[model samples]
Target: MMQRLRILTSHAAVNLMAAACFSALAALAVWGPGWVWAFVPLGVGAQMLNEYNLHRFVFHLLPPRAQWAFDLLYRAHYGHHDFPTNEKLFFVPVWVAVPMLLFNFGALWAILAALGVADAVWIAVAIVPVGGVLAFLGYEWFHMTSHLPVRKTRVERYVTTLHNQHHFRDFTKWFHVSPGGAVIDRAMGTAIDRETLKTRQRSEFIRTLGLRPDDPRLVSARRRFATRYGLTEGEIARAAAH
Candidate 1:
C-alpha cells in the first residue's frame, strides 16, 4: 500500500538523520578525545535505560490523561502485538519518532542544565536521541523484515524466526531488540527458550480449538498438522490460529 510505503520511507529517513546527528556528535567529541569515550557509554546506557522504561511503563501502562498519546502508542505498539506479521504497521511513524526525539532531548538538556552540566549537556542530549533513534530504527527494520514473505539471510532468518516464535508462541518473552536477542530478556525472565516456546505454542493451539490436551480429536488433529508442518500438532494448530 502507498500509505505503508510512505510510513516505511519516513521511518528510514528519520533513522538516517538520527544516525547522522549521532555520528556528528561523536566526531565532535573526538576532538576532545579523553572525554569522548567516557561520554559515549554513558549516553548509550542512558538511552538503553530509557528504552526499558518506555517499553515497560509508557507503552504498556497507557495512563488515562494521555488518551490521545496512548491511542497512538497502542497503535504503534499493541497494534503490533495484535497483528505481528503486518509489515505495513510495523515501523514507528515520524509522528511518533519526531515528538519522542525532541521531547527526550529537551528534557535531558533541561535536566543536565539544572545539574550544572550545561556546557557539555548538549553533547549528551544530542547523543541520547540519536542513540534512541538508532535503536528504534534497528528494532523497526528487523521486526518488519522478519515478517516479510521471503526467506531471509542466515542471521535475518534466525532472528526473524525467533521473533515470529515470540509473537505466535510466547508474547511475554523475547522483548529485546531483534537479531541479537539480548540478555535483557533473560535477565527479566522474559526470554522464551525455543523448546519452551514450542510447548507454549502447542498449548495455546489446543486451547484455541476448544479442545483439551487429552481430547482424542485434538490429539488427532495435532498429529496431522505436526506431520505436515514438521512441528507438533499443537504448534501447527497454534500457528494456524495465530
Candidate 2:
C-alpha cells in the first residue's frame, strides 16, 4: 500500500489535489460549521458519478478521425488502454485533472451561490476539495493498483477483477474504478453480467479500443509519444504486431 501510494502521489495532479484537500480540511477546522461536514458524503457521491460519466462518455468517446483530435483522446485515455501497464499512463494527465477540479468546484459554487445558500463557499469546499478530491484520490489508488502486478487485499482484488474485465474483456463495460463504485456502473447499465462474461470472448483489439493494433492513428500516436513516454522501439513494434 505504501508503495502504491508513493507511485500515486508521484504525479503532479495527485499532489495538487492532496494539497488542496489538506488546505480545505485545515480551513474547515477553523471556521466551517458542523453542518457543513454533513455534505462530505454528497461530494464523494458526486465524484463517483463524475468518475463513471467521464470514463464512459468522455474517455471512451468514438476515436476521432483527425490525428490531432485523436491524440488528445489518446493522451487522455486511449494510451492507457493501449499500454495498460505503463506507470506514466496510470493517472489522469494534469491538464485534464486540474481543469476538472476547477470546473466541478466552480460549478458547485455557482449553483449554491445562485441558490442563495448562505455558506456557498464553505459548502462547496466541504463537498468538492474535501470530499470529491478524496474520492478522486481513491479512484487513482485503486486504478493504479488494479493495473499493477501486486498482491492485493480482498477489496483490491475485487476491484482488479472488475477493472480487468473493462480492459481485457470489454472496454464498454465496468467503467467504475473506485471501490464500491460498481453500484454506479450497474445502475448505468455498463456493468457486465456473469452470463455475458461466460458467453463472450475477449474483445478484439482489447488493447487498442477496437482499433487494429497497427491502425495508422495508433502507430502514429506511438511514434509521437515514444520519446515522451520512453516507449522503446521494441515496445512500439510489439504493440503494432498484434
Candidate 3:
C-alpha cells in the first residue's frame, strides 16, 4: 500500500529511473557508430574514480559546522549511519540525488566543451551517463541489501557481510560497497583502521539544527515507513547500565 508507494518515491527509485533513461539514450545514440559503444567502459573507470572521491572527500566531510550543510548531510547520508537497519534511510533521498546528478553531468559537459571536442563530447555525454547510471544502480542495490533483509546468494552474502562490518564493527574502515571494491581505498590510502571513526565527534552545528542522528522523530518516522512494508529492524541494541 503506502509502503510500496514510499519505496517508489525513494532515492533508489531515482537511480532506477535514471539508469533506464540513460541506457535507452545510449542504445539510440545514432550520432555515433557501433564502435563508439566499445569505448564506454573507459568512462566507467572515470566514474568509479568519482565515486571513490565522493565517498572519501564529500561524505566523510560530515559533522558540519553550518546548519545548511548539516541538514544536507542529514538528508543525503549520516542518518543511515545512525540507524543502519532502517530500510527507509538506506536509499539516497531525492534532494541529494538531483543536485549530485546535475553536478556530475554538468561538470562532464563543461569539461568536454572546454577540451573543444564537439563530437567526442556528445559521445561521452551519452555513454558516460549510462555507465554512471549502471554503476550507481549496482551500488544502490548493494547498499540496500546491506541494510534491509533479503535472501542472499553465497556471493551476495559474502560481500554484504563485508559491507555490514563497516556499519556494525568499524565505520572508518571498508568504505567500498562493491565486492572487492576496497582496492580503491587501498590505492588511495584511505582504508582506515578498525573503530577509528568512533574516536571522532559530531559537529556542534548538528545540535543547532536539532536533527541529531537517530533522534526519536527520525526513528519514529522510519518505523512507520518500514512497518508498512513489513521491514522493521530485525535487531535492536540495548545500552548497558549498572
Off by over 4 Å in 1: 1-7, 10-34, 61-74, 179-181, 202-242
Q: Give the per-residue lDDT of model 2 (tens digit) for 126-177.
A: 9999999999999999999999898999999999999989988889999999
Candidate 3 global lDDT: 0.57
C-alpha lDDT (0 to 100) for residue 226 of candidate 2: 84
**TM-score of every prediction relative to native:** 0.63, 0.97, 0.69
* Candidate 2, residue 109: lDDT: 96
How far residue 3's Cα lies from its native spot in candidate 1, in Å, is 15
* Residue pairs of candidate 1 with colliding backbone atoms: 222-233
- Tens digit per residue, CA lDDT, model 3, 1-242: 35433553475556554765465465547555666566566655665676667765676564665555654664556556655665666776766555666676677778877889655655555545666655665666667766556677676786687676565555555677865577887786656555764553344222212244445544444444444334435422120000
Q: Which stretches of candidate 2 lie over 4 Å from their true place?
A: 203-205
TM-score of 2: 0.97
Per-candidate local distance difference test: 0.55, 0.91, 0.57
Better candidate number, 2 or 3, judged by lDDT? 2
Stretches of model 3 off by over 4 angstroms after superposition:
1-20, 23-29, 192-242
* Candidate 3: clashing residue pairs, number: 0
Evaluated at residue 59, the lDDT of candidate 2 is 98
- Which residue pairs of candidate 2 clash? none
Q: For candidate 1, give the lDDT.
A: 0.55
